[model samples]
Target: MDRLKTLMDWFDVRLGVREILRSNLQGYLLPRHVNIWYSLGAVLLALFTLQFLSGILLLVYYLPAADKAFVSVERIMNAVPYGWLIRTLHMVGSNIIVAVLLLHLLSVLFMGAYKKPRELTWLSGFGLFNLSLILCLTGYLLPWSQLSFWATTVATDAAGAVPWIGEGLVTFLRGSPSVGAGTLGRFFALHVVAFPLLFLGLVGFHLFCVRRAGISVPPFGPSARPAGVGTTFQHEVHRDGIPFFPNYTVKELAVVMFVLAGLVAITVFAPALFLPPDALEPADPFTTPDHIKPEWYFLWAYQTLKIFPSKLMGLAAQGGAMTLLALLPFLDRGEERRPFHRPLFLTLYGLGILLLLGLSIWGHRS
Candidate 1:
């Protein structure tokens, strides 16, 4: 008992136990105005943990080599008992994670939580989001399925449209003028090893900043909570919240457990899907799918490639679009965070999402 006390004391767990728990939550207690939006961050956090754990399980059964990747996935589906369940959970978990991250980002933007002290937190988060997107893209190709292989080819081919350096870029990405064995190996390395490390490092740094900044209250501030705002438990139980531990922390854990249960249930019942048998056949560089396209996230970029004319004009459009997206933090340089306040930014952001979705659909039809 004395030795345990010593360890706790050394870690400062006794003196700052409350703050330590609060450190895990990037928010203001007695948040003044709690809503469902506030819960998104917690949901996203849970999703990321789910993704990582499920991915690790899937990796044990996954074979990275081109010849074996499809076979390994098949084994997971048919032979490995709970392997299909784990693989499906990982797949669904990835989609859910991305969706939750987007929702969290939009909620922060709408609430103007990205202002002032929380800027670094927001910036690091956005960067991490972009990296996660890239990670998803790379991972999609690692399976070497018909959809995965062709999707990658079409996506990378679009990259080759850059004016002077386009050809070189394409060659580098595809490991030649075409997609083949080398492309699969490179993507597998990126998906399984490189991006995961990069993502974890960024996530750690982002969480640290959140801990330092605390959660940004809405622009209305703490005084805005009138007497009758009792829709959610957050507004009621945490209206004048206590320390994160034993209170919010307990609830958060329950929420995570619920999400985990759902994910596991899906994984066990549904499994990761495989495309048609013909699609599973070896990749044909010469042939393209009747409706060749990339994963949903890349649809917009792919569509952008289609709209622009070839040569200088097309190159300009494609390059400019990519540059704008990559430099969003720098481009969206307003101090304002609320959607109503940043009308122009919000409008453009929405339009951009729609434009991408529309283009994706249009590109496929053509």
Candidate 2:
């Protein structure tokens, strides 16, 4: 312990590492009312770390070529020691991160954590959410199986619904006329390189905004609410409150560890759910699979687009919803942060959740 302290002291003298840690973490304060929901963001970072590390390992053996991708994945599952665990975790972790991200977003909504002065934080987080979906979409095609091939073909086709540049957008996405070698190469580049870099940058800015704005106290806390919390505009800066380091970091790590345990269990025990038989079949553009669909995270949008009178209308609706979510802080300038006090926002939030759930179920059944 003394040697460790001496090493830290030596580094701190030159790098000021101890002061940086003190200012950013040990000295940072969060609301005493903060709960598990607030830690979801950290949980997201943890999952992203897991996804990144596992993905690198998978990339070691992963062949991004259309002809070899499926065979390489097969070899990973069959031949490489514990490669199945890493691959399954990577695949399943992607979906789980999306689910957890949605929960974090909705929890922020429920608690009004994205209210005034923290708009930048919300915007950055929403950007991360969108980029995460793109990452998943690009990664979906990496396996180059029949499922990914046809799915990519269908998904990229939707870009053609854009008015003037639709065709160009589709071509740019696939890097050619069809989902082939060019598409695989482009998607591989995006999944491994482009999107991850953007994600990391956005994540850095998001954390900065969060720290600068300070954690928002929930409107609906227990009877022992903080002063000036009910109704009216309240500043987010907390001084005489729980220290975020030891107090909240412990809680944050506990939740992340618990969720990771569940994720590993799902990956080990139920790989079949994520790794379907379609994933085993190599790409054969001539033979389209029966009733192909996207993974569950996208089912809501998929179903919505299908039920629309026209593809353009469906795309418009989905695009408009995302725009609204991005601009929510500006549109919702309500002074009251309490859920009960803001009936209209609550109603809209509830309806949106119900609509997404209904659409997802419809899409799954369809």
Candidate 3:
């Protein structure tokens, strides 16, 4: 231990590793009022870390060819030691990450954490969110199961609904006219290479911004201060808040452990039970399933497209909705930060959540 500490001290002298850790973690002053909501970011980081590790292990066994992809997955589950556990972690972790991201986004929105100085942080987070979705989309096709194949077809086909660029986009995404070996190869390249790099980069930048700006204070608690105060929230936090290392870190660690336990329980018991038996079959282009739907995260948009008679209109609506969400920092320009203080915005937010929930349920039923 002394030798290890000496080596670390020698490295830290040249690399400033200790300083970086001190600034970002040990010495960081978080708001006293930061509750379970603030732990979402830590939980997300933990999930992404698990996903990255498990994905690497799975990649050792994954085959990208259309004919061999499904068979390779089966071999991994049945033949490779503990490969089933690793695969389950990757699959279930993807869904769990998405769920946690939604909760984090909602928490930020309700807290008005994106206001003023934190706009760039919010923008980086939005990028991370979109990248995660793309990662999920690209990875979905890697299994090359019947469900993945047809779902990819439906998703890519929807891109062709765009005005003039639709066909080109579809061709680019599938690497051919339809989903096939080329599509699997392209999606595999993207899932394992491109998206992961981008997600990691964005996550790094997001964390830097969070550390620099500090966590947003609660908008309702005793530590809450109005937005226009000459003194920034960061200053107030530093003055009266607790150091993150022992106080807040404990809570965040507990949350992460609980989430991991739940993930393990679900993986062990459920184990892709939600996936239909049809999904286990290899792709058959000649026959189409009776009901085709996207993953639950995207079901809202899929349902929205179905509601509109015109494909172009549906495309436009979906694009506009995403654009609006991405530009929320600008669109929701107001001095008020608390949800209770802003009834109209709060009501609109509630309605939007309900609408999305209703659409997801309806899409699943359909």
Q: Largest lDDT belongs to which candidate?
A: 2
lDDT for 111 in candidate 2 is: 77
lDDT of 2 by residue, 245-316 (tens): 898899999999999998988998888888677878888989999989998989998998899998899999
> What alpha-carbon RMSD in Å does predicted model 3 have with respect to the real structure?
2.0
TM-score of each: 0.78, 0.94, 0.95
Tell me which residue pairs clash in candidate 3: none
List where candidate 2 sits over 4 angstroms from the true fold: 222-235
Cα lDDT for residue 46, model 3?
Answer: 94
lDDT of 2 at 319: 96
Q: How many residue pairs clash in all the candidates, one count each? A: 2, 0, 0
Candidate 2: the clashing residue pairs are none
Single out the weakest 10-residue window by summed lDDT for candidate 1: 226-235
lDDT of 1 by residue, 1-366 (tens): 999878777777547755654555433453444455666667777787777787788888888777888788778867998876676676778766776777777677666666554557777888877887877778777666777788787777767657679889998988877878788888878877898898888888988786555555554553543223223322223445545545555666676677667666666664433234544555555666666566555665666656766644655775687566545655565555545566787787788767766877876566
Whichever of 2 and 3 has more lDDT, that candidate is 2
Q: State model 3's lDDT.
A: 0.87
Which ten contiguous residues of candidate 3 have the minimum total lDDT?
A: 229-238
Better of 1 and 2 by TM-score: 2
